[model samples]
Target: MAKKEVLRLENVSFSYAGKKEKAVDGTSLVFREGEFAGIIGAVGSGKSTLLYCCNGLVPKEIRGKFAGTVRLFGKDVAKIGFPEISREASMVFQDPNDQIFNLTVEEEVAFGLLNRGMAREEALAAARKAVARVGLSEKLHDDPSELSAGQKQKVAIACALAADSKIILLDEPVSSLDWRSSQEVYAILSGLAHEGKTVIATEQDTCLLSRHATRIIVIDGGKVVKDGGVEVLSSSLIEKLGLRPPGPMSCGARK
Candidate 1:
């Protein structure tokens, strides 16, 4: 029997406002529950655009013309209410600072839960749980402005988890972090996947993808050129697809 798909994109295409060509063109893919999927591409390859469509942020926040279908958890994203979508899919952007608006760490984590109609006490408890899960329990009362970039990203992840979302769309989650922090974030993301959440991340670091992702989808010029398990994509093909090969350690010490 085939595995159940948590996300499905069927012949989807998107064009931003004032743009002549589509940012994402005729893309079709499936992301199953408990899968860790990575998207690798060169700059301007429409990786982010594809993620936006998955989380229903494309036609909602972006001024764009969308054609075709995107379904999340068996419901059409285009037809799902924004609030409902928020409950099912949460997104963390490339920049943690862009997503951190609340003054305190706790506030940031609780924002989504509150918006979802969770009572104050329940929301606070959930926030605490999420913070603890991300190893940010000690920073709950800290000012969001005072934390390091990586800590801020952890808070952002905590906030996403507070919503109890089934699908997470992370855009370049580790691009801005230091090596140690990047590993920390990867560990957290790995744990989420282990808990049966679908994780889809767009990354420039193919090494990290190879190390942590169950599958990698290579995109170029707004289309998917390759999609397969890490071992199935050759180093040469990764380079030809405009993606770098995994680091030596990631590739079993091979360069």
Candidate 2:
């Protein structure tokens, strides 16, 4: 069966307030259900900004000179309400601290669901199921503040799951985690993709990105330089973009 198209961007371009150069320039792409896509680029390469465009954060929340069209779930994002767009495309920010605010992990997970009109008991029940999906069932009642960086990141993911979002967008999710913790987060994301979520993440580490993401997208200077399977991470062009190409073992091992 053909995968459903979850996201589509056509000639999308945006420059932040007071920015001379476009953070995203004439970028076009399509994402489908069950794809664990990695957007890899060097710092200031516009990968993060590209993710922002997925859920209407580019021209809506963050004011800028924006051009082009972004379609979420086949509907133009410009025509959809921000709240409606957010439910389909849930964003996990770089810092878990930014997403975690409620006292208990369960509450943090249920926050978005409740805001979207899910009943109290039902949301908490969904929260438990979502937390377990990320292997954090035991941490449900614990304070999010007391959890480790990776666990907090898991909670952020669980929040998205509880809301029943089909598309998950993350920005450098493991940037603050230890090597082992980063591995765990990547594994969780891959599992989510297998479970039918269209998972898209922005990361600077090509090695880690290559290890997990089913597809690799290269972003440079606010544009998509390349887009294809995991093999692209091993390309010489990756080196020309000022980013390290993955080692032979990793390149050989990633699907």
Candidate 3:
């Protein structure tokens, strides 16, 4: 039997306000539950635009004109209520600072829960659990501004996990982290997938994706150029797409 589809994009096209061309065009794909998928491309290849469409954040929040269908868990994203969508999909941007607004780490994670009607105590408990999961228990009371870039990113991940979202959309999640921090983030994402949640990340780091993603979709100029398991991607194709090959660790050998 085939696995169930958790996300579907059909003939989806999106263009920013007054732009002449679509950032993402006629892209069709499906992401299954509990799978880890990565999208890779050059800087202008529309990977970020594709990520925004998965959770109904494109035309709705970004003021773009969209043509096509975006469905999350079998429901049309455009038609779903914002609050309802938030319950199922959570998005973390490249920069954790963009998402962190609360004063402290605990409050930052709990804020989403409280807004969704969870009681304060319940929200705090969830926040603590999430913090501990990301190994940030020691920094719960510290101001988000005071944490290292990596720590702040962990808090952002905790916030997403605390919401209990089934599908998480990450936009270049490790682009801003150091090598060690990037590895740590990947480990956390790996754990999330093992726990039966779907993770979709847009990244330029093919190395991390090769090591951590179950599958990879190569996007170029707003279209999918390749969709397959990492082992199937050729080095020539990686170069043609302007993507770097996986790091030594990702390829299972020491550098």
| Candidate 1: stretches off by over 4 Å | 250-255
Candidate 3: where are CA atoms >4 Å away? 247-255
Each model's lDDT: 0.86, 0.89, 0.89
Q: For model 2, how does the per-residue alpha-carbon lDDT over 148-210 read when each residue is reduced to its tens digit?
A: 888898898888888788999999998998888888888888887999999999998888887
Instruction: Candidate 3: give the clashing pairs.
Output: none
Q: For candidate 3, lDDT tens digit of each residue in 23-92?
A: 9989999988889899988998999999999999898898878999999888999898778898999989
Each prediction's TM-score versus the true structure: 0.95, 0.95, 0.96
> Local error of candidate 1 at 190, Å?
1.0
In lDDT terms, how accurate is model 2? 0.89
TM-score of 2: 0.95
* lDDT (C-alpha) at residue 168 in model 1: 89
- Every model's Cα RMSD, please? 2.0, 1.6, 1.8
Q: Is candidate 1 or candidate 3 better by TM-score?
A: 3
